[model samples]
Target: MDWREQQPYARKQGESFDVKYTGSCYCGAVKFKASSDPVDAKFCHCTGCQSLHGAPMQWAAIFHKKDILFDEDALDNINFYDSENKQNVRHLPCKISCKQCRSPIADEGRNMMLMFPVAFKIDRRNIPHAFKPTCHIFYGQRVADIKDGMPKFEGHKDHSNKIEE
Candidate 1:
């Protein structure tokens, strides 16, 4: 896999601050831009993430369904995989490349879409702010030596704290 970090770019900041984040696939055949900041960002140590990224963990930024815009043809070329029996997360790989070169571009399920920040073409600094791992699932499958410092919960957090809920 190709790994790279481009120079940081300027971004608007503060509550309500918004900016566009641009990204593309390895061959540049697939390109996209999200018009708003990510609602959530985190790293996953699940087996699916490991197998998809071929790494210890995978970094992602979650955006609302409406914020994402992409080339229709390129979007159709995306390859998807239902990695687990739970069928809660769908992996989207670049279709222009072989398995060895295939890279995850997003994860769609649970009514949300997570874009892999590493594939973005924008400056790293312009990327959305990320939050701590709110929770960790499938802990039993995690590496024994991996330290668990973030909050641990069976699933997503309860939004009862929100007044609207």
Candidate 2:
């Protein structure tokens, strides 16, 4: 299916509120607006994230699918990749070049879309409040030893009180 075909259900809803944040891709080929406060902002240490960002972890912000706004022309160049397991998640990255200079713009994933905060034209300090990293996965592959201060769990945890039948 196409990226537009796989658009999330939440995006169809009428907006109850609105906020704004600006984002762009690596080469500045893309530019866009996020119209809501991210629900869950954190870092992922999974191998896929590590490989994509060329870093030990990837910073991500989760938003309802409908909140993303982009230039119509930029939409054509989005590149999609199904990483690890196609059954579960996919990554959709933009392939546009900046209007003034050729630079790649941005990328989004199945559950989250990440934009480099440093790329925005405004003062970085005025950016939205960011929370502490909630949980870290792939602890085994972490570049350095896990620190002693943070809470560490053996595997994924379900905090919901609802018991499955």
Candidate 3:
């Protein structure tokens, strides 16, 4: 099975699961709803992520763009910043944040959006198994060492060397 297939939320053919997540910015100016299970979840230790999030790592849940629905206020309350290419922001991948509070939201890719799990309203003790991070990516760039047993990839999962503990 593919690495992603191991995720609890990875449904097989003809199988179905229903889960929803609601979240908003710190100031509550930007709200969103994810009506489906995430495609994947992981702890990212990339330098860009650390710098942008102001932390050593970032936990993000991946979802199809269509699965995420922004509230009507999003049009005016959200801002997109393309850290790689600034010329055509909307046409390329970018980071989405609240215009008022500047809270980091999601990283918008071509088809997937990596939503910051911290923004969601979830019970800390009852987080769903599927929402738990499965691995660490960009481990080589990490500023802090994580001794968790989860797979640690020096770069992108499946595309880079796995760091053995």
Best by lDDT: 3
Q: Residues 43-130, candidate 2: write the lDDT tens digits.
A: 5556765766678865555565566665445555444444434422234442123544434333455445554444444465565575
In candidate 3, what are the lDDT values of residues 12-55, reduced to their tens digit?
Answer: 56644344888889999988878787889999999999998889
The C-alpha stretches of model 3 lying farther than 4 A from their native spots are 1-19, 86-88
Estimate the lDDT of model 3: 0.81
lDDT head-to-head 1 vs 3, winner: 3
Global lDDT of each model? 0.53, 0.49, 0.81
Clashes of each: 0, 9, 0
The superposed Cα distance between candidate 3 and the true structure at residue 99, in angstroms, equals: 0.4
Residue 3 CA displacement from its true place in model 1, Å: 31
Task: Please write out the lDDT profile of model 1 over residues 21-91, one tens digit for every residue.
Answer: 77777776666667777787656656776776787666677777556655444544455565544342233
Higher-scoring candidate on lDDT, 2 or 3: 3
Reference-based lDDT, residue 75, model 3: 56
**How do these models rank on TM-score, best leading?**
3, 1, 2
Which ten residues in a row are the worst by lDDT in model 2?
Answer: 156-165
Between candidates 1 and 3, the TM-score winner: 3
Q: What TM-score fits each model?
A: 0.61, 0.60, 0.85
